[model samples]
Target: MSQITSPPRKARQAPVPAAGPDDGARARRVSRLKRRLTPYGFLTPTGILLVILMVTPIIMVITYSLLDGVITNKNPAFIGFENYAEVLTDPVFFKAVRNTLVFTLTSVVVHFGIGLGFALMLNSPLLGDRIKGLFRVIYILPWLFTVAIVAVLWRLLLSPNGVINYLLGATGLTEGQTEWLANPSTALAAVTFINIWSGYPFFMISLLAGLQGIPRELYEAARVDGAGAWAQFRHVTLPQLRPIIISMALLDFIWTTQQFALIWMTTGGGPIDATEVLSTFTYKLAFTRYDFSVASASAVLVLLMSMVLAFFYVRHQKSRD
Candidate 1:
């Protein structure tokens, strides 16, 4: 009876159905294939664009810069650094370098200061929303105008017997109408001012975004700790905003150093080369003097300088991070 009570042992069950070896292997292979393809799929477009737009032109520039005469139907004869040597020794090139540095440094400092001040002011409670928006639009309008239009407008304003002279006369600031652009001493300053006016809005908008990203709680905490406005800004805002400021300054320096249109339109690198920057000098070399090699060499130098600035900017950002 006891033996019978042990019910007949259940028939040996077949192993539960398991994933087939082929199916499991196929799925793993498919996943690995997709993982390998994903990165290439994303990079393909950018890689193609860089080769087409950037690498090709740079190769051409380097090749052309080595030649002696204008690159025409005839194959160019490589002159091995001749163009670079000539440019380096030229007085005009040296002058252009000096002017470029001055313009870049002045613009960077003025633009940063003015833009930061405006951003701070907009962040203040004294300025109502509507008023701040209105001012923002007005300040940004100059940036939207093309360089040619800005140059023409400023030329008219700075012309003899123009509105500036009229206003100055009315204010008893000058004896008579002055030719602002004709005077070499004042021409560079006038052009620099125009550049500052046109460029500062870009920095202002950038800094404003950076300012808005900062948390109000940080400021409140600092206040609770008996921090004054200057102390709070110094300890918190400046540190947080450092990266943005450095990036903007580097960009501004590169752009300002290569400025041509405003200088060309307003002064044509004249009042005796007073406003000649690298870009303008390159243009003059290429077009006016018919020296393509020199122009290319100058452009390459400018590019190298920009790269150096970029290197520093990247290093600074990495350190901060």
Candidate 2:
């Protein structure tokens, strides 16, 4: 009876194997790999887009610049730098360059002056906050309008018998209906003024922020040192704002040089190319005249010019940092 034989002794069971070091190591390696690849995975889409949109087009345009009869010829012939030489020697190109210089320099200078003046006024301790806020709203109104709207609005204002013309007539500021945008003599000036009006707000906002960030202790010390308002502004405010001013001016120069939409919409680079900048010159070459190769060359030249500005800007930023 004890003879159940201990219920047929239970069979020895094999102990379950513990996880090995190799398996744990493998899991850690997988996790590390995932961490390393996550950022690249996120950037993959953006990298593809940049290559497709920017890099591809740049390469194509450079290639086009070196060839002749691109887009119009099935098998374009290589012309080397001939297109560049032609573009460089072209009188129209020089005219465009001159116009671009005038437009950019005038806009940048006037923009800075006007912006700095407004920023100083707004930052004045004498001005009430409510008054400053109202002025800010009014000053920023120009920047609120789209470039297209600005172009259209100014076109209407500068048109013959428009409100501006009516006022000028009433005031006897001019003789007959002066075509502000159509007359070669006035077209460039008119476009430059429009650009200045539309762009100054950007400088104003940036300078205002910079002004607010300036340490008040500096001003107090200047005052304690018997420095008058002009001296304090010259020594303290100007120096404090120099970095912002330089950076803003450089950026404005680059942007203004590339300005096409405003000029195109306002004057179409018309009145015998009076307002023609490089951008319009290139546009007319490519689309209007169907000279893609020459246009590509012009575009490449402009890109090089922009690159020079960008190099200086980058160097300045690095020095600041």
Candidate 3:
């Protein structure tokens, strides 16, 4: 056997197989699936939070609005749009709407004017950087304060025996102490002024950034074309800032209409409802009168109004993009 063994029969070895097209294709498909799922995996947490916090509350509020005495009544009966009808017909609601419009419009206009003026000053080449920096600090001081702080500060200042009264008396602007916050004739104006003071800095900062972004070449070209200062501002400056102005105005409109903290802390919509706004109206209905159903209806109406503004805002932003 040792002599005639055919060089020791080699053991048969199984052939190694080549990779198939199906294997490669399956790998590519797995890779593609991973890429697509990664983003969704990241967004899942945020989506869950939004659903829990925002969507859930909105649905609850809407449901409450359709019922009668939702929280107060043990068995809330579905009343369809009756609450809405009541809210729409109430004289106080109408008054609140009017006041809201007036307050919001006035604050937005004044905020724009003040913000533009400050932004212009800040952007002026005539001023030194140091001066600009100092002014910026001063201008932004109002915005640095929280709503609670601003409310308290303004209340003290506008009090009958406060510094403002003393100054008015000293300057002979008024002979006696004026009850600014307590008087019906002045309460609305007082709160409005306070709101303007606090809000203008937001517009100012935005406008200043916008002003800086305006190309100097445009102004130079305007000058070469014999455009005066006012003309240049009307054409070049206004045109350049138009987008920012519109965006800011719409945002301010939305924010001011929803203002509650400052109004609540400062005036509580008091002085015979002179300063009553939609937010305050809804709040009074819910907490003051314990009318949750009506308050929910009013809140839904406010949400609709805000949605309209938001729609325009989104459209404008898309156009710009």
Candidate 4:
């Protein structure tokens, strides 16, 4: 009876609840940790791919640059810096380098200029949204085409009897049918023009995004300060878009320097090497001349220049952050 009474007399107690400030804090800590790790977790696959694909190829190229003979020899000999020295002294390499620099600088200047103008037009509040959308689609259309396709299209147009020359003659812009891509003096310039046309769309898209991202308050503030269109563009727009411009310029320069398909398909580094760039030269060294070692060396040099630009870009991005 006593035992039964004791068991019955045990007081009822409420169940302990789980949700509290400490639980919330622990959950929040877990959330923060997940947030911190999420990006890296996502990036891991890409990082692995880059190392396997991009980094491995680069290392292979560097090793090849230091070695002599890839296909012709059974046991490839190590040439050390001899390839570098020879490549550095080669007049063809110099000419190619000069042409590449010229092409990159000229094309980038025109690209930025035209792209900036187009972006400003697109960003104008005077344009309705439908019109803006239409024009934007049109602007990006050229970029959708493959480089090889554009090269083929432009090759046809730049031929002596092609549509472009016909139009030029029809418009009285030229005296006669001219071999635009055949003439040594004009081949590089002609190719340059084609690239500019094909490339400006990319610049336009980038700058347009930059323009759209700009706070309208800045524009209003500028207006309050009695700033006109040009003034507002110079002080407000340019400053905000400076980083984009610089980054785009660096990327464009690197790309233009290494551009191959369009150039090879169009000019083939011909007209007495008038349109020769580092990339074309490298290809010719490897395939045409069957000199893989020299080609690798040249490729290494190009990679070095790209690395320098990439370094600057990384620094710029970090500083911006």
Candidate with maximal TM-score = 3
- What ranges in model 2 sit over 4 Å off? 1-37
Span of ten consecutive residues with least summed lDDT in model 1: 1-10
* Per-residue lDDT over 44-102 for candidate 2, one digit per residue giving the tens place of the 0 to 100 score: 99999999999999999999999999989999999999999989999999999999999
Candidate 1: the clashing residue pairs are: none
TM-scores of the candidates are: 0.87, 0.91, 0.94, 0.85
For candidate 2, report its TM-score.
Answer: 0.91
Candidate 4 lDDT by residue in tens digits, 17-123: 97989999999999999999999999999999999999999999888888898779889999798888889999999999999999999999999999999999999
Candidate models: Cα lDDT each: 0.88, 0.96, 0.96, 0.92
Q: What tens-digit string does per-residue lDDT give for candidate 1 at 94-142?
A: 9989988888899999999999999988878898999998988887899
Clashes of 2: 0
lDDT of 3 at 138: 98
